[model samples]
Target: MKLDRKNLLWEGSRMFLPEHRRALLQQRKNATKLAVPKIDEQQLETMTYILQEAIEYEQPVLATYVTTYEVTCFCGFVDKVNQMEKYIQLSNGSQTEKIPFYLLVDVTWP
Candidate 1:
């Protein structure tokens, strides 16, 4: 049986044996076990500062980011570690908005 990129179990779904079903369930369980480091308020503030600095210097801020909120009920785990970019923008009233990369949970400034 081949699972497609869309996660559709095709080719033999209509004739899946009991063991196959169990295996599929186990795979889902394992996928849900992925975990991410917790992000506190202080950390968020710190990240914002780092983002601001990067934007000011016109440099990319690489970080191991994670999701701060669950977008779906079955999304049990936080986001995976990935690189991100940050920048600053001018908002209304001439205020500077530090656009920190969304869903960034961790960071390591170079």
Candidate 2:
């Protein structure tokens, strides 16, 4: 192989080996991960109130929550609030999702 700058380093290398490919994909995925936003006391109280309203009035809400990798928004009604376990159950029509209170970012009437 010629000693050109572009070819010198990878003269006989398998640049896309499975192990290297997997590592590169993992790094890319991690780069896109989102950090959780901080919720102040007033904001927390507002979200709590919205959840309570949803429960009492049987109304739907738009809830935004976060995870390690992404922020998710769900539209549903509050089904249950388990304070001891620190999670709330949200139900759309056919399915229900359990979301931890700590992960909640925002709640709005919808």
In model 2, which runs have C-alpha deviations exceeding 4 angstroms?
1-15
Q: Pull out the clashing pairs in model 1.
A: none
For residues 5-102, what per-residue lDDT tens digits would candidate 2 score against the true structure? 78667777855789988999999999999887889999999988888888888999998999889889999988889999999899999989899888
lDDT of 2: 0.89
Clashes of 2: 0
Q: Top lDDT: which candidate number?
A: 2
The lowest-lDDT stretch of 10 consecutive residues in candidate 2 is 7-16
Q: What's the CA RMSD for each of the models?
A: 14.0, 3.5
**Candidate of highest TM-score:** 2
**Clash number for every model?**
0, 0
Candidate 2 differs from the real structure by a C-alpha RMSD in angstroms, to one decimal, of: 3.5
Error of 1 at 55 (Å): 0.5
lDDT of 1 by residue, 22-96 (tens): 999988877766445568889878866765666566554445544333321111111222245543232233332
